[model samples]
Target: MPKAKLKPDVTVFEADQRQQEAIEHLHGPMLVIAGAGTGKTTVLTRRIARLISERHARPDEILALTYTENAAAEMRTRVRAELGGSETSQMRVCTFHAYCNNLLIRNGRNFGVLDDQDLWIYLRKRIRELQLNYFVRAANVGKFLFDLNDFMRRCHDELVGPEKYHAYVERLVRGELSIPRVTSSRDADSISDQEVLGRCREIDQVFQVVERMLSEENLGTFGHMISKAYELLNLTPELLSQERAATKFILVDEFQDANYAQVKILRLLAGEEKNVFAVGDPDQAIYQFRGASSAAFEIFRNQFSQSKVVALEKNRRSTTPILQCAFALIDKNPAIHATENNDAAENGGRRFQRRPLLSERDEKAGPAAIKDPVHAVSLTAKDAECSDIVHVIQQRRKQNACQWKDFAVLYRLHSHRDMVAEELAEAGIPFSIENMDISNTAEARDVFAIMGAMLAENDGASLFRVVATSD
Candidate 1:
């Protein structure tokens, strides 16, 4: 057999040495520590094209998993552009949830999965069945259900089932587990140990009921879909073997955002061949509260012991000043440095070391130099903060002769938007919120009422709503 040759049109050969190494790697596990603006997407798409062009793996056999649907779509489009639509038509590029959901759809006959809407409907109907001591009030029922759903989702992400949760609660009850004390005055409303144990018991009871209901109805939520897929792969040797054979290569983007369940699923799929390539930056990890592990690099290293690590240190998008400012801010967090050092010590002193980004942009060649890459301001009240922000934007617009489209206001929370929007509107400034929910708007409500009246025919409430909004 002759060795495979790369296609002449492939653009992966033009990448820098580190990126080229990651893209051209033929076998075994590899991790690429890609920083912001490091062309990680380029590396990923080019790697897929290279794999196909070199005849290492067919397009259909390669699986690319991303954290978001938009990222997956973008990756698919780039790969299609490289290899042509027809050649890459069968490639799998999707979110972790989407991949798991597809598997459950195809092989989860024993487990009937409930989507978000279905799960919401079922929980809304059966919520009252789970008797609770603290959160049993009628007014807080919605909050209780939401918190319960979130807790259960987190448990599922960690691969903890109802049985494990119940056992843990029992251990708490038996004094096998200790509760940490509330240290701050802000935690004055924190429950006592007895109350904490009581809540745990209630949660356990709720978990058992929900699991039983799912089992009886042969239904599972999106979280359950992931857990159930892992179960199928682990317990069924034949299915696992078939899946491993089918998926020859696995490439994960934004790997730091992957939870334990997703990581476990990938491990199972990789099997012994371990043709897994993950690219992500630990500094960009922001989903820890939602089960994304902060020590994702360490976890990946531990799992794939033979995996080679590569770093993309060039900052191709940002200026030198911006990179320097970011580095300074991040350096204040000693915990990150400590973790990196410890990981290096544990892994034969060959960690994916963090280095200052080398910006490709020629700062001196630009028309205007960046005077201040970062600015800081402190305001006491929310109103004052919003006012100052609007004032700054107005001044900047006037100075630069910029349009409204050139300005953007970002808030940490959705609650902050109302005040900022109020300030913007009062100043006669036009702005649009990115993910505003228009469903609850007056016009949307009126349209919904009209549709409801048309569908029901005899719905007096809907007709009344439509009539009330007409004038």
Candidate 2:
């Protein structure tokens, strides 16, 4: 393979030294600790471009896994821009689930895997058959199905199949396993050990039924797709080897948000070559509820002994003050220590390598020119807080002559929005809530009426709705 060189005309050549280093690194397991506002995507896309342009690897041999479809599309577009459509057409840039789905679609028939939609439909159809001690009533069937789906997804993400879940629940039943009593919320009732065990047993029962149904019908869910792919690869060394041979370079974006099954699939695909490039910030891991591992960074380090760690600390977006505020907040995490040795074994052995963000923006230009970028406000009550927000918006609009669309109020919770919306309405200020249901809106009703009129020309109700809504 030729040494990867940065061409002066290439955008990657203009990247900072650290980014250039990360891009130039062609082999071995590497971890890029990309903090917020850092150009991780730019580095990742350019690296792919360099790999193809310098003949280190062909576009088809590289696999880039991203957290979202948008991210994957952006990466593909950037790589295409750098290397052109002809050279980059064969490259694979997709989400972990997408990759697994594709893999299963191509090679999963040998192990009897069915489509995810079919699996879901089967589960819904057979939900009544899975007799459970709790949530078995007709009224609670919907809740049971929802919880069952969530539980199954979590189990699959953690690589815990029905057998594993059943075994674990049996241990709990036999008193071999114990759970610590921790109240998740002050207002929530504390669950007893017996209650926990009961729920676990019920979930296990549902899980086993679902698994059996899947086995009998060869049906699989989205989560099962990933798990089944892992199983297929692990059970068949020849197939695994073939995949590893085809995949010369593996680049994972948002690796911190990757679940256990995703990491396992990556491990199998990377194999002994370990030509894996993972870029993520552990602190930015916000998908724990979705089964993302908090110890993802540590797991990567432990799995790849020859892994090289790099930090992209230069934030191209935020100002110095904003960076300082962010640093102060994140530095409190024990994982962000400078270094961890035996002395720090008590503190989870230092999972992260600290990289303080530095602002690349010019202090005297644009938004960076603002003297006070951050503000702290304390309100004694929710009512007061909402009032204060309304006051601020009104004052800002009056002072700057800004339109209502130019201002935005963000709430940490949807519940908080109700009071704020009421406050804004009382103040005669117009605002729109993101993700609000628009089905009842006048525009949506108008569209629905038009559609109904077109589809049901003879229906009196459809004609009435159209006439009522029309000008």
Candidate 3:
């Protein structure tokens, strides 16, 4: 495969100081504070290319961490285009969960675990022991299972052990127990003891079977992979040393989105002298609900005292108006470090906009630099803000503003997606859910069946025929 040439200034749009620094550094624990649309993906791809071409790091030795399989695929595609070929395939471009799966599957029997379902069940039992709220309404076993599966994927083994999951569960139950009293003053409180009791019972039943399976059948989850990997590394430090010896660089994208288990894996892999680069935006840290901590950056900083912090704040995505609106919305959280001050006029600037020339400036000034000024607009009231946004969206629709493909509705949680999903449904608007795995589809049973048959005695054709006979 031909190598994609390095042309950071020309190839990548808005390749700013921070991004350029990240691309060229090729050393130590470095944190890239990549703001939205700041060409983070571009920098990452270039960084990977540099690692392979200049640093002489084998593609297989470098690891690129992502949040989702789709993001992983996107990263792989971009990196492949950047480096050009089966080269990027050698590099492990995967989510934290996928990395865990790789570790666990490769070394399953060492932990006395076999089969994913049994592993999931075992992990669920431990989660219950930890008293992790199987659901908002515990009686909702379906919801519990759905959430449990996801939770298991994230921290399978951490919950498997009695310590972490136990503490997590205790805290969760205590919080739930206090919810009723806390909301008693509210005239319209939603807390229900009956719901909790039912959910608790369902959890108890599910856990009982899982506990039995773990003790009797010896099963575990993906967290089991992390835990096992840690154990294996500890048990064979020389092996990990060898692995680290080969890896000249390990770049973790969206580092802030990583949980405890993942950080542990990286810490172990990075060891003492290995170079590690983590790029993410803490302001966009939305997975606190799922146990991700931005504090990993702080920890890494402290651990590697020589580390340099780089901020890729100049966004090359939204227009002045869009950036202003997005930034305003993002700043609602207290944790955000407000670099752009109260006065939006001078401080705020838009790096990029999608469209034809709107102003007289464009007509006279040929094409402005991609880093042309963008003015920030403050949103005073929720209704006014919504109205303003609706107007822009409506205008876009009328003028063929941006293609439906260009438009995206982003939120911090699945629950937040509900309103838009419902509205889209009612309006009969067709849209597909992005950044989700095919394995997460409602037809996961079919996938499981196919996988099971492929690995088992039965052929996939026979299993498909059997599964297709729904009636």
Candidate 4:
């Protein structure tokens, strides 16, 4: 596929110079620190467009990496529209794993790696050989570990440097054995080992074997891919140089959510050039449980000589009171590293307008017999009509009255829907429940309609064959 064309020159608004630097800066490692709703994505999209238009980066060479498929799609759609391209064919956008798989598959023969389908089987077998006991015991512990590692990394980034965090992790790992020894030595009357615990240990041993094999193959997991991508690029100077030459600028969104592996990948890709821009909010960095290292953001200036940090504190969501409440809660986090500029502290100091939530009893108070303008009527009975009226107010607040797609219900339990749904019906509000089994719902009808449409075309036989094979 050909490269994506550059977007037209346009001045993009970033809250500060740091944001502008991230959006307009070309080449090299950079970081932008902002709070939630601080236009991080907007800055990132503009940066990508700026690189293509001004920096002359080829669409293929400029790899846009994201954490999820939904995020990738969002970026791809934006880039495609901005650059004007055959998105499906030209855009080389994907999550880190997807990107690595593509790289391995396309260049697999160069590294003696298997094809995509075969690679999965190969990795599974190798992981089994690794014999990682943690994974074997719970079957999901490996994922949990990765998540926990990410979260820990983010916490470390926001509080301390990676070196300190690394040391902390090492100490924790070494301390695990001491607890059991200490307990055994202290209590001579207690049994040496519990039977159930022994059985669990045996399973752990089996998992360790599987984990050992997986790590040995070096086929690469998500963490491995982020780590290996850097190594691969660093080793291949020509390819690395080509990417640097083609793409003048690099911008990363949600920079706080970046783990060490991702930071390494960005550093390698950026090389010595000072064109890379990273943007994220430290306050919304709740993903530290994943391998997202916040140090990449908190310590970017320290890590890179040319890096500049920017803070965007304006909030687009929440009222003044709501923002004040959230700020008050977030201030309680002891681990939050303060900035020299003290923007967060200054912004948070402003008092919020008071707006108290009505008590359940107050809300349940009945409407008075008098026509009141200043004081609102309160519920006083278990009357369904009054409850339904209240429910409508609550439901409308949660779900907008736009197209059918705009509405969604977030219920704690399925039974909780009856009252709200009945209220909606009484108010003549329209909604579609998406919880029904898709096979028995309108989705099935739509699928059949599309299938019928396809069958009417010239390639009807292929469709028929597929249906027959499925059956």
* Higher-scoring candidate on TM-score, 3 or 4: 3
Cα RMSD, model 1 = 6.2
Q: What TM-score does structure 1 among the candidates reach?
A: 0.78
Candidate 2 local lDDT, 52-155, one digit each (tens) = 88888888999999977878888988887766553466899999878887877788442333233334444666667887775675376765566567778889
**Please, what are the lDDT tens digits per residue for candidate 3 over residues 1-471?**
444464434353545565677889866777776777777778887888877766467788888888877788988877766654535667888887676566655655433433344333435445545444435344654445655555545554333543454454455566644422322236425657555544544444555455455545444544565666776666777767876776667788887776665666777788886488888876667676556665656566655566666666665545554565566676564453212112224546321112121222233344662334544458876345434544555567779757666656665666556555666565545678765655654367456656666676634332532344334
Candidate 2 global TM-score: 0.74
Sort all candidates by lDDT, best to worst. 1, 2, 3, 4
Judged by lDDT, which candidate is best? Answer: 1
Per-residue error at 78 for model 4, in Å? 2.8
lDDT for model 4 comes to 0.52
The per-prediction tally of clashing pairs is 0, 0, 11, 45
Per-residue lDDT for 54-77 in model 1, tens only?
Answer: 778877899999977778888988
lDDT to native, each model: 0.77, 0.76, 0.59, 0.52
Clash number for model 4? 45
Model 3 residue runs over 4 Å out of place are 1-14, 84-86, 108-160, 163-212, 215-218, 336-439, 450-471
> Per-prediction TM-score, please?
0.78, 0.74, 0.64, 0.55
Q: Candidate 4 regions off by >4 Å?
A: 1-22, 55-58, 80-92, 109-208, 215-221, 234-247, 299-302, 334-429, 432-471
